[model samples]
Target: MTAGVLSPRARPRLGFLGVGWIGRNRLEAVARSGQAELVAVSDPAEVAARAAAEAAGGCAVLPDLDALLEAGLDGLVVATPSAAHAEQAIRALRRGVAVFCQKPLARDAAEAARVVAAAREADRLLGVDLSYRFVRGVPELRRLVQAGELGRIYAVELAFHNAYGPDKPWFYDARLSGGGCVMDLAIHLVDLALWTLGFPAVRHVESRLFAGGAPARGRSGPVEDYAAATLTLDGGAAVRLACSWKLPAGQDCVIEAAFYGTGGGAALRNVGGSFFDFTVDRFRGTARERLAGPPDAWGGRAAVGWAAALAEGARFDPAVEGVVAVHEALDRIYGA
Candidate 1:
């Protein structure tokens, strides 16, 4: 389907598959866009589902994926567990429903590729919540890099450190959550670096994983709480990433992505240890220029964009290939 084919009066009917805090937040954002109609919500937690449904003005609280799909949805918003993301998204796509899923789209690159194939075969729209790319500072930095203003990018440094770990039990399970800090947090950092650099092919990756402050080895072991990896991209551009949970970093969180190029450098750093507040700056010879700052309100923009695109009859976007690239990078980092 093409954007021009949709009638202005027609709104896409969307189903929320997991209405937890993140799920409900995204649902409310899409609702506020007024481009998609919330028709059904399904979550194992009845209270969460009820809250989501109430927020959607009494949308039906369905039992599961089967019921939500049967509710005649044009798209499905998947906020389920990592292990279930691929199967759930593929099922919705096979049913001719568009999908907007939370990140780590699948456990690995192979799973992510399968989901992308399903979307292509079904001719349905597919979007993943790589939300950091929607931040105000991100686009400004991307524009500079893409416009050749940054020159030949040589090295990139990305970090995401959180003082508190996930509250969910599944996050600690290797099989269920994939990895730990790498999959949960560094995924965004990887995406931001490679994405801003225009999805450069990652030629090699080396990583060290730590669980409970001890080296984590082997594939089927406990998920790591801290991880550091270096990705060597095609053309010799290097990217370094480090992420951790509950680390005593002297702050609630620390998030930054810095790119160094031949001509200049640019970086997006969190302000006052805030996850949502960010500041972007371009550097040259010890001089800096601010490009963007806080008060951005970028948290749910990715969800809103997906909802709006679905309403416009947008179909499978080729750019989803970037998502697969990210998964491949993660697989390399995990040595999977």
Candidate 2:
């Protein structure tokens, strides 16, 4: 879809950058939503960019960010590797272009803060693809907790384990991908817990990092494949997190989040170790309540939400400050 096909006010011209599998997937999501008009695509890989552009149904293919920016885009979707996220997002926001980028937004809180500042100055919407927030039952769970329906959540436990590791080598480099499976995977768990609880300041953080089965020794050494951390929040609540990659875990993946409250407790967990399927449950003593189940098409929700908001002329959302908070917590876990 292009601006010419819709009323002038109805479509927002968007650009896609780094059209890898994830990027292309989000592109398809936005396109299918019919909320935004995709105008151009850019990627360093010629074959990948061409394929993505073609799949976008005749959207123009630009060779680089400069060309894409010059195409008069209303927003940019960034799916580049971790190292380039902060710089690319800053540039797009400074150019008055809204951005929806993959998670980490940056390697640390400092970089994330800079990107958020750029969005604030430009008065443009900035979003990070912390896609788990869009998962089934999460929003409902968050609402219940926030509304005091769950009543004074005292403790939370979150976990994400993958039997397979990343396909890229940079994922093992601390300078490039930030940290190991923690940043690439567990960051989602950390973000989900803090965000679910309204982002109370983490008063204390203690962590253990491991490579294979051994503990991490030095900061400059290789990244850890396994990690566990405990967070003590200022609101008198505590959170525990555990995540890993290629963990000899019997399942393809294991994901779960549970919150314990004075009055009741709620939990969400994947079914059959499938990355895409999950079920949410609420508990009263030994009795249980099922709130949600599988077949939830949620992976595309973040991209679609950004596209819909952009179409509505949404400005910078202060909720993006939560992105900064999530990054800060990860920084503490990494001892950065």
Candidate 3:
């Protein structure tokens, strides 16, 4: 069916699975947007579920995915652990429910492909919360590069380092969280690089992983606390990525993505160690011009876009294949 804008009374009913901080945040955003009706919430934690239900205008609190599915949901919002993402999304899709899920989408490329196939078979919408693309600076930078304002793009550098590690135990488990820094943080870098460069075929990938200041012994060993990788795009552009947790960087966080071309360069960087505030600039010779900056409410844009797309009757977009491409790159990085 051709997509069109939805009215309030015609909005799709949505159920939230895993009402953690991120989940609730997205729930609130979707709830406030009036694009979807939040009809149910599911979380193993009673307190979290209750909070989410209240935020969702007293929506039903169900016990699990099955119960939520039975509540007449038209879509599912998944904020569960990384390992469970693929299975949960596939189940929802098989039952004909659209899904907006947190990133990594799956533990690996094989799992990601299954989910994509299910969505295609079911003719349902599938979205991943790669929130970085929704940021204010990203699209503008993309415009410049695509317009050739950056000339022949030669090199790109991306990094994300967090002073504190995840408080959840699952984040440290290799099997559950996928990998450490690469999966959590560098995923954004890889996505931005490939996306802005128009999804060029990645020709080669070389990587080194480390855990607790030592080289990781094996895939099944400790999850890497630090990771660095280089990707050579088919068009000959070089992309480098690095990310870490508890790096003693003397800051709360460090995040940057810089692209260099033969004519000029452009960058998006966090301001003063603040994660929420950012600045984008273009460089020409020794001079620089600002493009965009702070006070950008970007965290919830991806979720909001998904809800709006669902409202518009979008189903099984061909762009979903990008998720598999990203997972394939991650697989090569982890040597899985």
Clashing pairs for model 2 are none
Mind giving the per-residue lDDT tens digits that candidate 1 earns over 139-251? 98999999989899999999999999899999888788888889899999999998999998999898999888899873468888889889999989999899999999999
Model 3, 1-336: lDDT tens digits are 212233434789899999898999899999889989899999999999998999889989999998988877888999999999999999999888889999989988899999999999988989999998888978999999999999999999999999997999999887898888888888888888888888888899999999998998435789998988898998899998889999999999999999999989999899999888999999998999998898898888999999998888787898888888888888888882
Each model's lDDT comes to: 0.90, 0.87, 0.89
- Please give, for residues 153-261, the per-residue lDDT of candidate 2 as tens digits: 9999989999999999888888898889888998888888888898889899998988978887424588888889898999789898999999878989999899999
Backbone collision count in every prediction?
0, 0, 0
Candidate 2 segments whose C-alpha is farther than 4 A from its true place = 1-9, 217-219
Residue runs of model 1 more than 4 Å from their true location after superposition: 1-9
Stretches of candidate 3 off by over 4 Å are 1-9
What clash pairs does model 3 have? none
Worst 10 residues of 1 by lDDT: 1-10
- Model 2: weakest 10-residue lDDT segment is 1-10
lDDT of 2: 0.87
